[model samples]
Target chain A: MARVIRTIGWTLIVLGVVVLLYVVYLLWFTGFETQREQRDLADEWSLTVPDDPIDHDREVDREAPEEDDEPVDVGDAYAALWFERDGEPIVSDDVIYVVEGVDLPTLRRGPGHYPESDRPGGEGNFAIAGHRTTYGAPFWSLDVLEPGDTIHVIDRQGREWVYAYVEQRIVQPTELWVVGEDPLGSGAPMITLTTCHPRYSDAQRLIAWGELLDDPIESTAEGGERDEIPES
Target chain B: MADNDAPNGDDPGPRADPDGGGRGGIPRWVKAILLLVVIAVAVVVLFTTVFPWVEERTQDPTMGTMLTPWLAYLRF
Candidate 1:
């Protein structure tokens, strides 16, 4: 009967509409949740890391947060990451807070630090994972970064660790070795950033590796101009 | 039976009220269309606003993450 046909047609239309709206939610609306969380994390970072710069003489004897390094809670924000090209910031006009874990909930908040890896500015590998296409897509421009670009990580004490981009690789999600010890076999303090490969899909992972520069630029307590931190 | 079909050769179904609609109210088709529209709007609002708002607090596994395996299967 026409009524039966009409009912089926209406059901299909409703289902189609839901599917379309969900796609929109995935791509667009989800970012709102991330942005709000990022804001809260930024505020928390400022409160925890004071604006006052460390005294140079006292700082020389003090290492980059490793001496008193404590275990970070899984979902806690620990550091801020920003990108630069030839010393000019490439993206992240607002620094992206790196959460402590790569689990689903933690990553939905921001770039997540692999708990197995060393903390930012520590020895060995400091690995992080981020969403590239949704939840604010903090690493959306990961592919655009070229070797020799810079990634600056500001730790809890406001000390800036500058890393020079070394290489980028696209690998299967199962390639756990990419974040393992000395992934590049360089035997240096390195950083790894991972995100789902092929924008809008997660069939693979895009990894970018960076090595810490010889010296880290310490942010002055003033902390007003984060980018102006002179290379020490 | 032939009288059930209008001059345009279409059946509007039996009219209980005999005023072209049931109980002298909106046509059944119009009501059905309205219901569909309401459902579509609710779905859109739930996905866009209500769900995202709740997700910010609940931190539950997101639909995107849960559907990844299915999406990969569909693509392959």
Candidate 2:
């Protein structure tokens, strides 16, 4: 009887050990490691902006030649503003805004903003949200982006607007100021990218803010020249 | 006493039955119950622990190559 009891105890101990090992393997070597690796790679490519130039304005608005006004190609416009990582396309169907005087669209779970808010390409903050972990993790590397990395927002009219990153902040889920109606003051054009924080949970949101660096630049024109319109 | 002594005099003392009074062994129902318990435990371990861990690893962009299907699922 004693021998049988000993055998049962030994079996339970072995089972426990096996379970523990499996848990450790999954935690350390599986999805967690993958997330870390992707972020690390992204960090290598992110360019940091210098603090000394914070007050300096490098905005530009070059007027395009009136004669070259043939309808701009939307495909070219998309290509001009698109960003790629590891040869995988990161841009989605959603459009980001970079033009002044445009109102930000309403925040929603899916594609396109609320109808009452600004329409895509119309301008304000053409904000978009994506999952940081699931859904192919499109914005998983967004945190790796640093100040000065270019964000391009192209319109269907073949007008491409360029933005330079200014700052990034991790905000609580309840903080709506990151997407405030008066982001950067009234009529200040900006582009905001948001994603789930910590790259694992949706408990918080991470935001990256940028200001328009130049006026709408048409892709059809030679050498990517900016189009000038009267300032609002 | 005379009838009991003569027929089994050559036989040894009363022997114990190897089959325990002809009673059957553990029932099939008991075996089935044990199997179900094992399966339940395995499922609990998988969903509560294993699944989350796998998800975390796949979320990592660096290890994304190891989970091609997981990455593909991210597209809308």
Candidate 3:
């Protein structure tokens, strides 16, 4: 009986070690791997998103990327987001990339724009999602946004849509009512950003909402301060 | 006139080696049963716990598409 108990104890210890190792892989090593993968995505998006222009302003009557317009791939980066807090593209700051389609592959690149929703600066809800803790964790600092903070969404043509942060909420993943709405009733374009809450768990979801300002500012390739072409 | 057939004749049908199952000497049936149990546990743990935890932590962005349904099923 003593030998049996001792053997069982040893087996438990071994199993415990294996679980610990797997947890480490999930938390740390996966981030490094994802960052490497995101680098490739960023490089490819730099070349593609620019040449393809998407118009969100009704005044312009420009072509927008919808299912009917073109079949945007799931992982295609449609826009780039910059925080006004960052201010003037300094070192250690990167424009968070927003790709088309909210899925594992698309979000692995950065933030993912939910398909079947309005584009940035459009007439309706432009909902997006990202990872808070892993897969490059683009929205890791999302909690830091305060009401009235400015979020810049620049498009492939270097046109910038400025949105003012309104409010944030935490809800279950099933509480997806915040996703789609008629901005016409609200009389402005809206944005919704989502991620898992509590930093390390997915039991809940964190959501940030914003409203796009009218008369969005446009940055020309020649006028923009940055050397690289903008792809919002 | 007889084929030295162990199946027909009296050959204590494949007697266990005096030294037990194999090099480990624990008995082959015991090892096989143990392996099967481990695999079943691994499958349940992988879908119900490990994968969900990984998806939560890393967001499993690209593959997360497929895992969404599995996560939903295992939520309960």
Candidate number of the best TM-score: 1
Off by over 4 Å in 1: A52-67, A216-232, B1-76
Q: Give me the displacement of residue A224 in model 2, in angstroms.
A: 28
Candidate 3 residues A1-232, lDDT tens each?
A: 5535754675677667767876677667767766776677667666866543333342432345443234567877677776654233311167677778886656666788888788776778888887887666777777666544666776555456777766676765666566767522575688888887657766567777778876543422123232221111
* TM-score of chain A, all candidates: 0.84, 0.46, 0.75
Best candidate, lDDT: 1
The better candidate by lDDT, 2 or 3, is 3
- Please report, in order, the local distance difference test score of every candidate based on alpha carbons: 0.70, 0.43, 0.62
After superposition, the stretches of candidate 3 with alpha carbons farther than 4 Å from their true spots are A1-10, A51-69, A86-92, A156-158, A183-185, A215-232, B1-49, B52-76
lDDT digits (tens) for residues B5-58 of candidate 3: 345556744443653453445765785578668756865786588776666544
Instruction: Please write out the lDDT profile of model 2 over residues A1-232, one tens digit for every residue.
Output: 5534754675577567767776566434444443443343223213221222111122332243434333322211111133323322234322222212211111111112212223233346655454465533446567555433556644333345566555666755545555655466747566666666666654456676666655522322122332321111
Error of 3 at B38 (Å): 5.3
List candidate 2 stretches off by more than 4 Å: A1-117, A155-159, A213-232, B1-30, B37-76
lDDT string for model 2 (B1-76, tens) is: 3222335457522432243211354444564466567656866786688765664443322210233555445522
Instruction: Give the TM-score (0 to 1) of chain B in model 3.
Output: 0.44
Model 1: chain A TM-score against the true structure:
0.84
Q: In model 3, state the lDDT of residue A147.
A: 47
